[model samples]
Target: MNRNLAYALVVFAATAAAAGQAFAETPTLETTPFVSVKTRADVQAELAQHKANGVNTYSIQYNPLKSFKSTAQREQVVAEYIASRDVVAATTGEDSGSAYFAQARTPHSVSRTLAGTPVNTAR
Candidate 1:
């Protein structure tokens, strides 16, 4: 009787596992293959435009820094960085600034519960 009971339990477990797997929803994939809207000439024209713009992306000696120039003055950039230094440090801290932001008095930090009671002055 004990052996028979163990066999029944094993059969039940196998059936339950198989049913779980068989009833699982499968992702449906698109049947149609992809088709390109642009012709070979369109691609060639785009490459030509990039070359005209002095951007040689395919070249091994490509350097974006060669043409880069900052619009902001050095003093202005340094001042802006100094102002945001504390905020940046807090955000990148161990707790990811959750504690700092929670205590922050910014407009976005105002909780919905603290929005104050609505007043009706309709006469």
Candidate 2:
């Protein structure tokens, strides 16, 4: 019984040592050197410059007929669409020497059918 207890203690000690080593090796959250953290004032100044350069902010309109699997997916798609539109709008505004305001409307959704029956799922 003493021998068995000693062996069990040895195994437990080795396991704990390994676990501690692994835990020490685990990466901690560290700020990346390449990433620059901008302050609120800096952000406001950048936005002001963008606006002064004739970049007008606009709303993104999603198609009512389109079906999104989830709100997050819809938001991601809309964000990407808006980013592209902003680039175009900024260029246009700069060329015209005036701020251009416009709403981006998503294209109509593809027609979905089930068992030869057309489904109108518009939310």
Candidate 3:
């Protein structure tokens, strides 16, 4: 009985340690950016460029989740939050995906989808 209890505790302790590490490694408020910019572009441009380069696809990725405070300065915080995401997408060339965010002091959360297209200038 003592050995069994000890083994169980060891397993639990290991799991707890792992979970704590993950949380600690997660991005902090200061590390995460608060401004972003993106371009509405020709998606096919990537496809064509990749093909010409003998590749099947070109892709970019960014963290889709963002956090903000909904305190008295909700609008300011939210604006910065959204801008930060735009910058990520533009910098990485990530063109698709949505945002899932939560306020710092409330249960309020939001999800928003972004779409874009490049204007044809050759005409």
Candidate 4:
């Protein structure tokens, strides 16, 4: 009985050591460089093509009241925005246009509870 107990303990310790060594060997990852890289001329040609695709106008909008601390700060923000827009328009052969606003729907079009009655929520 003593010899069998000793044999069992040795087997268990050897199995545990083998498992630890097996887990210690980690596999390494290999990577390759990109097959094709774009050059400066390639990027320029792409931009020219984009310009020819009728994407010639852009618009910028900002809420100055929420973004700025005071009127002077708001004016400075607007000036900077206009300057940046002018720069992009000149460089890309595009024009800066007026700000766009989505049209709001009438109250009757929107769902509302009328006179303590349940409204139909399904479309």
The best candidate in terms of TM-score: 1
Candidate 2's residue-wise lDDT over 39-121, tens digit each? 88999999999889664445255354455456567789988998889667675674552444332333354444569664666
Q: How much lDDT does candidate 1 score? A: 0.87
Residue pairs in collision within model 1: none
RMSD of each: 7.3, 22.8, 25.0, 19.8
lDDT: worst 10-residue window of model 1 = 112-121
TM-scores for all predictions: 0.51, 0.19, 0.18, 0.19
* lDDT: the better of candidates 1 and 4: 1
What are the per-residue Cα lDDT tens digits for candidate 3 across 36-57?
3433355667667767865332
Candidate 4 colliding pairs, count: 0
**What value of lDDT does candidate 4 attain over all alpha carbons?**
0.67
Candidate 1 global TM-score: 0.51
What tens-digit string does per-residue lDDT give for candidate 1 at 1-123?
999999999999998988864476889989999899999999999988988998777788888788798899999999999999999999999999998888786877565643565666475
Task: Candidate 2: list runs displaced more than 4 Å.
Answer: 21-123
Q: Once superposed on the true structure, which residue ranges of model 3 sit more than 4 Å away at CA?
A: 21-123
Model 4 Cα shift for residue 109 (angstroms):
63
> Which 10 consecutive positions of candidate 3 have the poorest summed lDDT?
96-105
